[model samples]
Target chain A: MSTIFQDLVDTLRKSTLHFADTKKLMNTLNIIVTIKQVPDTAEVRIDPKTNSLMREGVPSIINPEDRNALEAALALREAHDGTVTALSMGPPQARDALEEALCMGADLAVLLSDRAFAGADTLITAFTLSRAIMKIAKYDLILCGRQAIDGDTAQVGPQIAGFLDLPQVTYAEGLELKKGGSLIVQRGLEDSNQWVQVKLPALITVTGRINHPRYPNLYNVADSCDDAKIKIWTAKDLQLPQAMLGLGASPTTVKKIFEPDRKMKGEMIPGDERQMAEALITKLKEMHVI
Target chain B: MIQLVPEKCIGCKLCVKACLFGGIAVDGKVPRLTDSCTGCGACVDVCRVEAIIASGEKTGPVCDFAAYKGIWVFAEQHAGKLHSVTLELLGKARELADARSAEVTAVLLGSGIAALDGELFRHGADRVLLTDAPFLANYRTAPYERIVARLICEHKPEVILIGATTTGRDLAPRLANRLRTGLTADCTGLEIGPEGGLLQTRPAFGGNIMATIATPNHRPQMATVRPGVMQARLFENKKGETVRIAVSEEPGDGLVQILKTLAREKSSVSLEKAEVIVSGGRGMGEPKNFKLLENLAGLLSGEVGASRAAVDLGWMPHDHQVGQTGKTVKPRIYIACGISGAVQHLAGMQSSDIIIAINRDPAAPIFQAATFGMVGDALKIIPELISQLNANT
Candidate 1:
């Protein structure tokens, strides 16, 4: 698997070289991939007694959508010969996700972890990420998942774009190198899709349709154990004021938490196949579904 | 209670435009707030220089009569048709309305929508507030906000409920900002306190937790409930009285109108109205695998949905994504495949009539909400389940 990946990388490098002097290939590329670690949703269980999710033993993994973002970055790096950096803000355990990105071919990894980063809503999260990106400086591209599985706000990407004052291409499915250091990309809208040409150093939030991410093979997995080196950054490293890192930075706050009211009790309409179908149909009709 | 620093202002006038209440005016090159400034902080978001700050005070006038009343639901309409979520909100509103003996009124706005007044009555509205005008024929944010804001100001309804649809989501925040009240968006539950305060509940922290909020000191506590979260009232064939109000002709131009709107095409999957929904998650592994969900949905005559995970993965379209950032669906039967029931994902579909969870992990949080649970691999079980469903069909 390692040989295949190396061969693929070589092929990509050669192809990119062939396109050299093609105005789009002239500039240096700096790519930032944003990621997160979330509990495997399929493994999470709600404790009946507590009426809350039972998260204790649930396995945590890199957010599935973020994996796509990483793959897109890796592919871009392989083609354009650019540096791909992985960045994440989470608890200490989230370092594991950064390590995975390194194994997937990222050149560098940075984890934004600190107690001061806790209880951040989307607005604060965007503020922190934008500040961090600004500190990183001279990045030609920014890649992010359309939304995180945990928060599902889908606001951070746009909000970050707003903060950075960069034109954003959201829900991108594909990209092509264009003339004059510009990229022609496809953006998926609600009713239909449209293509836009954006100058370099732009922010893009990707949807899942871009590419199939390659799995880590035995050799890469083994090498990852030795090669993985993550740079840990805190509020101080990013040079952000203490008040702007966490809950205090967030304008919106969650005032209380409660279980939603369940109006109808689940009733099992049981019987043989035909009987069950009839019962289901009858129930649907009674509920005005017909 | 939001304040702006004059020195830092770039004279962008974004705050002036964001102020729903016409309280802030641009004086030469600076934004000036009046005594009518409600302190809602709606203008704070438009400050590019971070000049506007929330003062954290209850700075608005206290409507004494509104303090004693209960919650109210505004039934929104478009093109003379009442939005389906209106009835759903009425059902939820009835509960809170009954708690405080507060009458549930459905505020209808549109030209010639008075004929549909009986529909709201049958669906549980005690009174219908009607405002008809040619300007309302199309949903322009300014006109709708004006009528709704005027009604709230006049009637002094303690609580206002609106469906979190495109129109509702757009109008609610503006109205709340104008009224100097707090608004909870995409709420799934609502409760009234003994003091007639509204406890608005919604999923937060990416759906990891549910948050209940209230405006303790504000009147006309506002909330926007997503469609399908609340059950629609059983319809009865009865008419209710309609009180008509005059529509204003003044057009407020705060923003640019660059493009004319064309006719919108109908969506392929109206999951919002589906009786059964079969949704997939990242567990499906790849975009190509979403075909299985589509096939299963076809057999069941249901709509296909995806968690924000799957949608973000690009396996499905954003329109099919169900969550806080995506569309909220309340089907009668929701079959979750490889969906871990993340708080964000569950917030969108938890109100379904029957939930069926299919995952390898028996401890999947979706199982807690599922009425029937099949603890096994979705890839393996879905094919078999699809076959069984097909045979029965």
Candidate 2:
């Protein structure tokens, strides 16, 4: 077994470390920031025949929100003592994103690549990530972007938490570590922002407003390109369940994902408030919209 | 498994004629699925060539929730109080369950919420699964996760509804993952479909389309219902049974401890939660001028909002700014005042139910997108409109 996997087995066997003893057991936090290399959504097109994303031609970027997640992890490293690991599950070309993350100061980068993982959706993606995270370390925390731009599902991070039986906070805009191994986070939900305190060994999917990402220095960029230390783990390396690796493992499939017709090409109404309001309300009433 | 290899298919009309469900139709040289084809091999029967293959899908462990029979909702709590969205979910779930001839059950987890089980029933639950633990007083994932996962595994409800609050968002996925079940997030609508499947509908692609998803193969279909979309029906006198279960997972083991919970302070009109909003832009001119919009908003019982340009010019506070850099609002009505809208500003409020733009510049892009538009100055038009509204009301 890999030493990282062995560490997890050892940690599990040793019993839960008390908050007081945790600081002594590991002074530095081990954080794994899960990211994805999604095709630039701005140029997204769907293959009508296949109903799959046409990811060709549109260059891939480290998912925009993942950049904020990486920035959050980096900030956590700056505040506390820890190494941030950038991890992704995608095709072989996903290495480019890992390289970019390394340039942005991720301490270690790992990629889980295999033809078996190609059609994995959020559930399977989370399963694959949890396996890699276990192989990486008995990490104290896992961070992810709120959602990838391509799928925009916001499911993977929390799903990973489920697989690992860990606590999760999604849409986190602010995060901080408390004195006794607790994590304080500002979660931005659909309607409100809430401050929550969660115990360690948690996962947080950060929102884009969390932090301003820093551009990597030229030296670091070239260095990461030349000496990129990305560990590639496949199904065999993780020794995961075969059913959970590919499409066969997926519990749900996209029946269809065509763009909807929500576009409103508004028509200008010539009138003042009395005329416009009455006319508009009348139209809305006619449609039973009001 | 099905593959549509455009190159291999010889544009044979045989498969088109062979499809039983009319799922396939010829679109130019290639065949396109006019409807959702079941991949039932009818087309493969008459392909006359190797182009169509009967690919078998490996059915891995059919852990179907089909055996489950009751509809369940997770009554969400914050700081020991139940949320309104819980009621919303229960109302919707109760309707769906009644349609399927199933009972509505609610799972309540908290320190001292047994007495509150009545509240769940009042909102529509027929039964309550109450797990009260000292550790459950605060919303922590570990304890709640164990109870939810265990309850689902044991009871095997036909459908589970959860309010898509922050707590539900975090807790639902973890529990669903543990159950190895499918969950639809941020769903706006739910109904019982064929074979008692939960038809979960939600907006996708930036609210451009509404997608209805179902978990036919999985049992106990789960959905996280969005708040405010569903009505919260309350009964003066309600009936329900409370079942207590012993939780196996200890509370504190969830390594994370809550030291403090800071709820976001809503001092003034939060643009996000407001039902109606009237926003001003830089064209309103001055900080004092915002009062005119506020007066108009008061007459309409709405909140005053600001465009990024107005906020940037110190006419209004930054907290009120609406755009890409600001909070997105989905109010019932959005009225833009003197605002020549920018794309960034439009992105924020375009999703509102009704958009009314009042700008002197008829050429402004906002006019093109507004549900109603008027070419006039805010200084002259809004006061007259407010006076007219006041006189009418």
Question: For all the predictions, what are the DockQ values?
Answer: 0.12, 0.17
Q: Residue-wise lDDT of candidate 1 within B1-393, one digit each (tens)?
A: 667788888887866765655768777667788876766554654455656765554244354644446556777776677777898998887777787777778888778787887888888777888888766775645567767877787678877888876556546655664554556677777887555567777775556667777667667777777776788876567566788888776734222121223343667878887877889998888887788888878877899999887986678877788877777877878988899777677778877777877776655667767766666667766676566666655
Question: What is the lDDT of every predicted structure here?
Answer: 0.69, 0.72
Q: Which parts of model 1 are misplaced by more than 4 Å? A: A1-255, A258-290, B1-70, B234-238, B262-267, B273-276, B285-299, B322-332, B385-393
TM-score of the first chain alone, every candidate: 0.83, 0.76
**List of chain B TM-scores, one per candidate:** 0.81, 0.68
C-alpha lDDT of residue B334 in model 2 = 91
lDDT of 2 by residue, B252-329 (tens): 445655555555565586777888898999778788988888998887678999987787667887678775445567
Worst 10 residues of 2 chain B by lDDT: B57-66
Give lDDT: candidate 1, residue A237: 81
